[model samples]
Target: MACKVQKRVSLRRRLHILRFLTNSNYNKLKVALENVKREYENLIATRRDYIRLLDNNVNDNKDVKIVKISEGTFMVKVTCEKGGGKLVAILEAFEEICVNVEEAKVSCENEFSMEAIIVSEDQSLDVTYVTEVILKAIEK
Candidate 1:
């Protein structure tokens, strides 16, 4: 009985010390790697936003564009000749992607242009996918 208890205590102490030594260094490295990865992701997102800003209005005879302005925000620009109740459907599509409109403006100078600033809680939203969805909505 005495030998069993000593062995169990020795095993427990060894496990505790092993865990403490491994977790500190391992956890620190893991956290640093995660932080760097997030920063890289955000940097990629920023570059995409910059590129879109330059060529954002490329109509090419198409309507609707979802452009990411920053990490958690996007600008949705849509052109429609018929501007009665179509904005409602576009807004619905944006909401489906978990976005809230921060601001919206409509201007018509031979072409109706609707610009909306949208924000989302999700930081990893796929910019291209959302743009495609908005394009389909505008197409309809």
Candidate 2:
């Protein structure tokens, strides 16, 4: 009878230890998740600030922005107050410049906006010249 009581006490002690460890682990996981959430929010805020800075530096008069992403890849963005056949015209201009459009996203609701990823075979593709060509196309 004494041995049975001792076994029951030992079992209860072990269960108590297990419950404590489980709670400790749960608390640790909760803290880690909170930290990850904080980092994600900080990242989002930094991105928003970066985008705002870019917007502030942009020339309102010009509706085109072309950035050289890599050696032969360019990211093109165009925004205009008018919407019509601008998409077709811009694609035609890209064809003339001999740049392949790998991906393009266009929004023509109320206004016109286009973002394109262009890959050029010509390593010497001039950004200034491409900007000028796209500007001309937008004007037309």
Candidate 3:
């Protein structure tokens, strides 16, 4: 009888240990999940702030939109009320700024509309500067 009782005690102890381990692992996973959620929220907030800054800088001009796609790449879109040699002028301006046109889609049938992927070696180039240069090209 004593042997049987000792065996029961051992089994009970093992069950308790398993339950404790399971609860510990559950707590750890919960904490990790919370940390990931916090990090995601922070990343989203940072992106929102960056977009707001870009909007403020480019809001004055409705004819042009310039967005930085990556470190040295920009996406530029321009729409003009008139179409002529504006496309050539814009290309020249891009050359003057040392920017290369990686890809572009342009329509100069009735009005001028262009979407271009531009890459630049100059790290200091920003949306405002590119916008100004394109605007000047459109005027000329």
Candidate 4:
């Protein structure tokens, strides 16, 4: 009958519309995902550059390690060769900027290590300044 044909066509049309909407939503989600990935990649690249600059600036005469123990706190630990007095002075200067050695121990004659915690009181201290301090300390 004609009525039966009309009902079938209407159902078919509804199903087609539903499929189109689903495809559109899927495309939108895909685009959003790509945008997020790109932004994340950019952030990672920037962080890498900043870290590279810091590492290069730091004195490499010995083995100096800086690790972030928390979100806003960092620990600078250094183990240097004999006569590392210059590096010590540089670290001491950090005290003026509120960087303090929470624990420092110097052994008999083979090793010396200090755990200095750097926490910015104003959250405005740039890592560049910290890098400069490290470089200056190692300057010959």
Candidate 5:
């Protein structure tokens, strides 16, 4: 009878130990799961912000729209998100490219827009070549 009681007590102690270990493992898994969840949330928030900036067309800086007004005259339109360097470079683009500035209008603000009517100073002014030079200056 005493042997039976001892065996039962031993089995009960073993079962209690298994339950404790299981609970400890469960708690550790819960904490790890929580950490993963937090990291996932942070990643999602950062991605959302990036997508928002992309959607706003913030990457549309230094975009150019040009139209050939005549054989030696061309209309150049440039858009910039920030900085006055591009604006200053554009004024110098005509001199650098050896072209005449017929007319130019610039508005300095959040999204600056510059519209210019550029003409060739001499017969050397090629429409395609001058357009490329102006576009490159808009990048600066």
Candidate 6:
């Protein structure tokens, strides 16, 4: 009976040590994964900042334009156009301007007018700036 009790106590201690080791290893892995994620996010932010700086320096006229023709009616545009051909070209332009656009109702005319209803989440200057950019892009 004494021997059996001693064996059981030994087994319990071994199991406790094993569990502690496993939990410690798991916690380390979790920390490593979190660090990796933070590093990845930092890299992405750096790349984005670099691209923003490049675009600003290279393209002098690239802007978000807005115009208010009347009360409760406005037009907006951005200068981030890409892709191939004219339709694609216009679409790319629209996309470039839309990076900062939160919500908008858009209508495009291949030869005429491109009208849109824009709702911006945050604004530094005014909503009319968005409209001006859109008009300029469409005219181009």
What digit string (tens of lDDT, one per residue) describes model 1 on residues 1-140? 99999999999999999999899989999999999999999999999998887565543445767788899888888786655456777788887888889999977676667889989878888778777877767666
The parts of candidate 3 lying over 4 Å away from their true place are 1-62
In TM-score terms, which candidate is top? 5
Tens-digit per-residue lDDT, 1-140, candidate 5: 99999999999999999999999999999999999999999999999999999867775655777777777787888776767477777778788767777898988776778888887767556666766776777666
TM-score of 2: 0.55
Residue pairs with backbone atoms closer than 3 Å in model 3 (clashes): none
* TM-score per candidate, chains pooled: 0.50, 0.55, 0.54, 0.43, 0.59, 0.41
Q: In order, how many clashes per candidate?
A: 0, 0, 0, 0, 0, 24
Candidate 6 to truth, TM: 0.41
Q: Which stretches of candidate 5 lie over 4 Å from their true place?
A: 1-36, 39-60
| Model 5's TM-score against the true structure | 0.59
Question: Total backbone clashes of model 1?
Answer: 0
In model 2, which regions exceed 4 Å deviation? 1-62
Error of 3 at 68 (Å): 0.5
lDDT of each: 0.81, 0.88, 0.89, 0.67, 0.80, 0.56
Error of 1 at 133 (Å): 1.2
Candidates 3 and 5 compared: the better one by TM-score is 5
Among residues 3 or more apart in sequence or in different chains, the pairs in candidate 2 whose N, CA or C atoms overlap within 3 Å are none
**Whole-model alpha-carbon lDDT for candidate 1:** 0.81
**Which candidate tops lDDT?**
3
Per-residue CA lDDT of model 4 for 8-120, tens digit only, reads 99999999999999999999999999999999999999999999987765435355567666655667765554464754575666766766556554542654445466665
- Candidate 4, residue 48: the lDDT equals 100
Model 3 clash count equals 0
